[model samples]
Target: MKLKNGKMRKMMTVSLAATMALGLLAGCSGAKTPVSNQEKVLRIGVLYGGNMDDSYFRQQYTDIYEFDRKNVKIEIVPAINQSDWRYNDGSEPYKEPDYLDGMKKIMTGSNPVDVVVTDVSVLKQLIQENMLKQLDPLVQEDKFDTSDFVPAVIDGIKDLGEGSLYALTPSFSSSALFYNKKLLSDAGVEPPTDKMTWDDVFNLAKRLAKGSGKDRVYGFSFNRYMGNDPFWDMQYTYMAPLQLRMYDEKAETMTVESPQWIKAWDTISNLVKEEVIPNNNNVNYDENWTPISNDMFLSGKVAMMISESYYINEIADANTNAAKIKDYTPVDWDVVTLPTHPEKPDIGGNIYLNNTFAINTNAPNPESAWDYIKFIAGEDWAKLKSRSNSYEMVARKSYIQPRQGLSYNIGAFYNIKPVPPTNPKDDKLKQEKRGLYYVENLGRTYFQEVLDKKKSSTEALKDWSEKGNKMLQEIKLNPKTEFQEDGTPYIPEDNVSAAAGLSSKG
Candidate 1:
């Protein structure tokens, strides 16, 4: 549930602008005095970097919040477009912006930004650089009541700020373990509960799986939209929760051959061999089924799945169109917290904070910026935003309810603590090795061999590690080096500068 900026920010764009305005004039303790005592301008920086046209922002801003604009002005500081805000799906090559570099330029130069509207990734970076003002003092000064905030979100941010608070987010995204009540009841299998381990979930899946051919029911699917590679989908959920990594702490060696990883591979492989989970080859898709109709759980072919809260909207839409699809009816489903590991009970890996707001340490109008952060994070704002279809869960829990007439568990989305930070420096390592994530794709092939019994988990992992180490060494020797299918170095013939004596491929 890492925040997809494009998808999540669309919901917050205008309203977020409004929050900035209302808070701007409400608290002016640090506000600069106007030459005529008539007006003061509040400068806001859209940190995630999308187009922030002034007229459009003002229109939406005024529509959401009412305040005396007679003596105050709202201005959006220009931001260089950071990335493609339109395409969140991984269909295009993503360009990672140097946010620290950009913020350094924006905040230090003339007419610097006073407030920032950003996501958690940038918020963490800003806090690390000590460029953002701590909000704890302001919270106490204003007597801001944070009691209603989703505990996991507040706690996670505090953990990042090293026992202090640096930012506030109004909404977050999370996943839950959704089960088909009808399937479980019909099969006489117990439904899943919060904090179950991988073993517990797989065993439950086994009991619910039945039939063969077109009627075959799998016990579980990692995601409803697992297209061609269900194996990868299943592995990602288990891998993160279990704290598996492709490389060791230093990124110099692969860790796939370790006992922890070997056990994980064995667990997934055993389940696939037992027909409890569906792989790419085994999932049944009818030719007559529409694109959305291919969802296993929606079609009643899977008993359970773990997916984000937005998935509920898809379920609702399917129910609305149930009559249009032949031989298909709406699913009877409810959700619980995503399954946890026995070693890390009650800590789930599927929570994300988005649209977080923070004031710059060098803010020209610190008091006004603080007001905006407090206003948007307040209960009143949460109530207004919760009524929209914009977010999966608002940070304020009192406003996070199940859809109008539904009775399913809404608390499942935020009932567990987030997986605590494994290491403070892991973020840097992740950034450095972002390009090396291709190893996951490479491991997918060997994992399939393990599933087919062509090799044991131990043997498959050994081979994956050997090949992975080769790829790492190749990248280390020549950063631009690309690999051949067998994991040997292959430099393109035209790129002679990066050849580094490796075999050239046309």
Candidate 2:
């Protein structure tokens, strides 16, 4: 598929959380491979999108399950047309999939689809629609062992089912607060602890950030992928955990003029002004005005950052290439649970489960489907998949370990629980008025105005709310109205402020 410049990169970055497959299947010597009464075809449904093909799906399941051993055949059913449900970030407006009808057709017949696999978002929808069979009865009957699974993964899935087990996932993706041990020690600051509040981290950042231009060290970065678009950066990372509301209950009006919104904007702008966090000013543009580098965290110049498991690969790769590159230092880092809101201290907003599996309620071979689910979510699968350097975290807690010769707080990835899904209302609004999705982008411009000191935080939000309300009205009246910002269209890029002196060149 053809994409505009930078669109491919952005799409990949946005889908990073959803990209990794369960990617594992393991063989056991003493395992009793369950079989159907006859040689029945175990039809497996995958939430399909992007370029993932049926062959890839076959490899993911067939290799591990050893269907031939059980006299079974594998068939892949694409449950949805676009797997955009995987995009949990609000960057794109939610598009409710019509998979419910598709699900009915595939899941309700004498020879119905046996298994369904999907991300947690669609898993919730499947459960609510009664398309999935609760696994509790199967677990009890088979005496399936689940004690080795990560508490967060098992508990989070149960929470989705309101204290029931409707599905099981082999792996999860989550963000953790990683800090440079030496940087904090050298700066005479205490290392950040697990579950630190955003305010706590920001205060420490204020203390640790020091020096001017070239030699300056930043205290914290929300993520290593901070872009030149401050409004998008703030909205995507910093403000997201706060759960700031962008629209009313009906999503037909703006809701950003509240005191809470003003406080959030002020807090973000103040951090930028104080240089406690990396902003556009921290980056260097080349002669042609192209961004060169923004990975200050990797250069050992940023004290702390919030990133997912994929970043570990980047860091390892950077370290291996450090000697070949100029003036680079290998970073000594460890991670802890991501910062939490004071009111919701146990919640981690960055946790995601993308490889969930469940049996169809009307499966032709429920026993065989149960066997497949257990095989994937079992300990052997985690053990094998964990050894790979994939950007996903295995659900079995015991299998998770540090890099071969390294030791760090690996528990940080799964210790904190995920924030509950909040897309039901948003989904309803999107179906009613598709244009309501563009309202948040409008706020980005006003937010940048506050950051640039062109407008007071309160005034900026008030103006933003006025404009947003007007746009929502237009969208409600004419659902096809296009949103046009006053200035240039913002194209978000993957650039962050790097350490000014840590040149990529030798």
Candidate 3:
């Protein structure tokens, strides 16, 4: 999440009001000193997904800041976790306020902020609460064209009501299955097919699990917490092929109890119960998912794992700790889209995770803020991000290109077709891999929440279907509004029935 200037100052004003009432004017006044016209600083709040020095985050910040420093008068005050914020200057690191506190600090300030950037979900909350400014008028006056933006990315940022657009998605990612070539070969089984079903994966896991008891190797591992929401992740990756829609379009209700969802959960439960997968205790973040899956694959202790594309590179490139597995020897392993359910071949889509950006409604200078937004969305930014250590596929259709010396391919895959520039070098491998797409995670939250309660699969699905529809209705009933004289819009009471009346159309 990133914050632009205008909203931060507003939050600051609101936060200081009580202090002013209590006669603590000295502190509030000190914090509200205005910046001189000569000092043009853009204060932004950002969520650090990786190390501050990480190439992807580093390059994005460098490019934007460098451009802003020279091309426009600007100061960038970034708010990130203190431990994560790094700079050569001796200044202390920034700290994140709790959600409400942060909102108050930015909303009611005397020296109001200029602009803000963040995620769609956060922006949605602010927009509904009348804490954000609509970018539509600014875009219209500035003639900002969205033609170059990906449709899916744009759709992800729009308010559920279709009338307003609150944020811009700059980049995106989806998860896939990463397997160890040596392990599969040693097990006498071929690599899992792009079209394999969950049952097929389970059978292969049985074949791949090796060793006994204390020395036992398990076939698969995933996080298990009510908060973890494997139900949504697994359903999107596996049941998508079954064409399972949790919410009915015409009826406007959840369909989680559908046969497809039940079947998917039952399959996972069987795997857990049968010991085909390691027990939950074996699934620690350090050992199971993050660097561990990579470690296990490299050491031949695990055959295949479900993870993002970035993890594959991290494992294969490790020199000191994970140099043992034959597959970890760069160029030995490969990636394919997550397997789909057998019945609904077209059901699942790519599960894009991190590639997103949003605007703060409380921003002071949205016009100038767009300059940074446009810069990050350009070809140069995409190329830089793609080449960074955390190599992510660019979201734009025009930015795909072949880079020299890199062994792993970086391109989009939808239903097994490699959508890349027509290069002969890229053709042969296209047939072996497929790409899947998915809706944003928010769309599936209901099923996830229900599943966490240890409810029957059928009950969870039904609950999600009802709750999802209710949420949709709320969004539909509450259309976005222009700013009022007070810089705030009147908020309606929570009305589930009113929200359900909303159409899911754009």
lDDT of candidates 1 onward, in order: 0.70, 0.69, 0.46
Best by lDDT: 1
TM-score on alpha carbons, each prediction: 0.84, 0.82, 0.53
Off by over 4 Å in 1: 1-38, 51-95, 226-231, 420-435, 492-506
Candidate 2, residues 1-506, lDDT tens digits: the string is 00011011112211212123333322442235753346667788765533354554554445556533456677787756454566467676555554445556767766678988766655777788888899998788767777888888898889878999998888777788989988999989999888788889888888889877656788888777535455666665556656677887776778888877887789878888787877776643222211214576876557998888767777777777778656677788899987777767777547777667898888877877877787778776676667652666788888888764577888888787776655444655565554565777777777778777899999999998888888877665555444555622222221112212223531
Candidate 1 vs candidate 3: the lDDT winner is: 1
> Backbone clash tally for model 1?
0
* Cα lDDT of model 3 by residue, 386-421, tens digit: 544254456565664433434543332323311111
lDDT of 3: 0.46
Model 3's number of clashes is 61
Ordered by TM-score, highest first, the candidates read: 1, 2, 3
- Candidate with the larger TM-score of 1 and 3: 1
TM-score of 2: 0.82
Better of 2 and 3 by TM-score: 2
